[model samples]
Target: MAEPTTSSRRPGPGAGSPAVTTPALERTRRRFLRRQRARRWLAWRVVLATVVGLAGVVGACWLLFFSQFLSVAGVEVRGTSHLSPEEVVAVAGIPTGEPLARIDLDRVESRVGSLAAVRSVAVSRAWPDEILVEVEERVAIAVVELGGRLRGMDADGVVFRDFAQPPRALPRITTDTVTRREALTEGARVIAALPGSISRSVDHVEVRTVDQISLVLGDGRRVEWGSAEQSGIKARVLPALLQREARTYDVSVPGQPTTK
Candidate 1:
């Protein structure tokens, strides 16, 4: 070596001398680089795992719910009167073999209640394989002319059905006095309260105001019932009174009977 020169550049934060390498320091730096690379690899692996797990979860859920695995096995009905079971089911349009998860309850109810006989309908899931349908039927009490058609009425004057001809057993309620609805309402309630035997005997009923109410019997006799309220009681007592009189009896006072 020539003359030994003093170093111009002082050691930085890590470098100490040029000739002697610090093996412990170099090992520490090398270890740090290795750890940094390992951290990057671990982060990449986590991202890849998250992406794959999301894909698998989506695939599994799609296979379970969307697949039509379960179906409507049976349909049960209650509260049906005039409407047949087959007709009610046909209106429901509930698809067989369709998944129960997708069962449209509102759609089914709206369909079946379209029949005139069905006043309201309710649907419930019976679990696993069946659906239950409960319906409220429209009671047929009498038929009255509505808009030139014979419309059916219940005990509450609700006109549900319009047919060309009235049913055989149901009474024909008629009036020429402009066919007032208030009279029909009062008549329906009064008719519903009468005894079954007496109510059934009425062939024709008229709602021609308080003074001119009339009833034609099946026995070729006429009753002079003055009003709808008293007529209900008259119906209950008319048979006994008729036996005594043999002619028309005004049982409007209910307990008192006068022959006509």
Candidate 2:
């Protein structure tokens, strides 16, 4: 009776279920799983490599910027003529042992350029252990009386260094009233235009207003220069006019020059 009941059910495999695996198939599946595991390990290895690379870059940045390995050990000055290297370095105030990459080049340049003698300045890092500062000094083109002291004026009309006595090579600039910047600028333009031969004979430059400028020669000869306009033409004509032995030469209108 039990055998007859068992005949209604299947014994080899369950209905709608897969067949049991063979030992070879099991081994193949295990190898495939091992391969998948190896692939996963490889992916993890790539991720680990990327992380290690980033960490190395971060470490290198730290060593370069934050550590003393790239710090400034000295300050080097160049292109300094009127100012001594020590003076430039002292004013630069660049701290030694600071990170070279972090040094404020603009700040350093500003400090160095503040010196009256410096016309322009550049600051930069000089490799592993130095900060380089290059400076251009202002050249004296004329001398002006300021506060009873003679001061050197550059071509840019900036009155810079003070002198105990007027320089023999440079012409004196005098303003009728108390020194005004506009008058000085006009006088500077007039003086700058004079030929070397003519400039060498000049005694002092007279500035009344922006448009009123004149020159007095060492021989007590006066030159009426008027405004700073037509300076090149005036410069060309003055030497010839002076050859005529005039006490006063008017080259304000260079084309219609007059001598008295």
Candidate 3:
């Protein structure tokens, strides 16, 4: 007589659990899915940005170096008086249509400075397409006759240009072909030191040797300058000495000047 056995079996794991989802669990799952999608989008964005940056860099390099946008167009010369602009440009030899950034400015300056008339030169890029060459020409302080031709001599004793006719304003120095270069230099120094007040009265300078220099006035008076030494003192003393009536004035020893 046993009571009807009620067989009871244990439920398997999750077999009988309700098919239910809580709000928090559902929200967590959505967040995880959104995180995965966010990671994928971030990766794509990073790749796109990297590609764009590389393209910009490559484009800039091409424009600066390889392109013809910055090539030289022409050369302009300035501060040139005795030398024509064409002469300076010819000697500069700067190639046209070449890359302006690649031109050697130092070389250009050296070439232009080689001209005897150019005392100094500066070369620079005028940007966009031009090259500028500035030349400083030598200024003649005196004139000399060499080989039957009148030549201009700068203050430094450099004989640069030949004059077709003698300049009436510049004081002429008498030096033959056989005259020593030292004598020419000394004579030039002496002439440069004279003040305009005294120099204007001089007709010509006589250069016998390096130490022997004399200034002959228009009225036939002779000034024994002796040498270039103490020239400043001599220059100052001579102005006062000239006020006296004398055929010859000696300022060789400025402290003990003599007039006869």
Better of 2 and 3 by lDDT: 3
TM-score of 1: 0.56
TM-score against truth, every candidate: 0.56, 0.81, 0.78
Error of 3 at 33 (Å): 13
> Which prediction has the highest lDDT against the true structure?
3
Over 4 Å off in model 1, which ranges?
A: 1-67, 71-81, 84-111, 162-167, 209-212, 226-232, 244-248, 255-257
Q: Show the lowest summed lDDT stretch of 10 residues, model 1.
A: 61-70
lDDT tens digits, residues 1-260, model 1?
A: 79998989867666564555699988998999999999999999999999999999897666544665556777898888767788888888888777665788988999887877887899988766677899999887888886688988888878887767778888888878575777787667666766777767888877776455667777767777766676656777877776774557676677777877
Off by over 4 Å in 3: 1-65
Per-residue lDDT of candidate 3, residues 66-160 (tens digit): 67898889999999888999999999999888888788999998898889998999999998889999888999888999888899998888889
lDDT of each prediction vs. the true structure?
0.77, 0.89, 0.90
State each candidate's clash count.
Answer: 0, 0, 0
Tens digits of per-residue lDDT for model 2, 1-260: 45544457655656877878899999999999999999999999999999999999999889878999999999989997767999999999988888888898999998988999999988888898899898889988899987788899987788878888888999999876565798898888888888899999999999888788999999899999998888999999998898897899999899999999
Which prediction has the highest TM-score against the true structure? 2
Q: How accurate locally is residue 182 in candidate 2, as Cα lDDT from 0 to 100?
A: 82
What is the alpha-carbon lDDT of model 1 when measured against the actual structure? 0.77
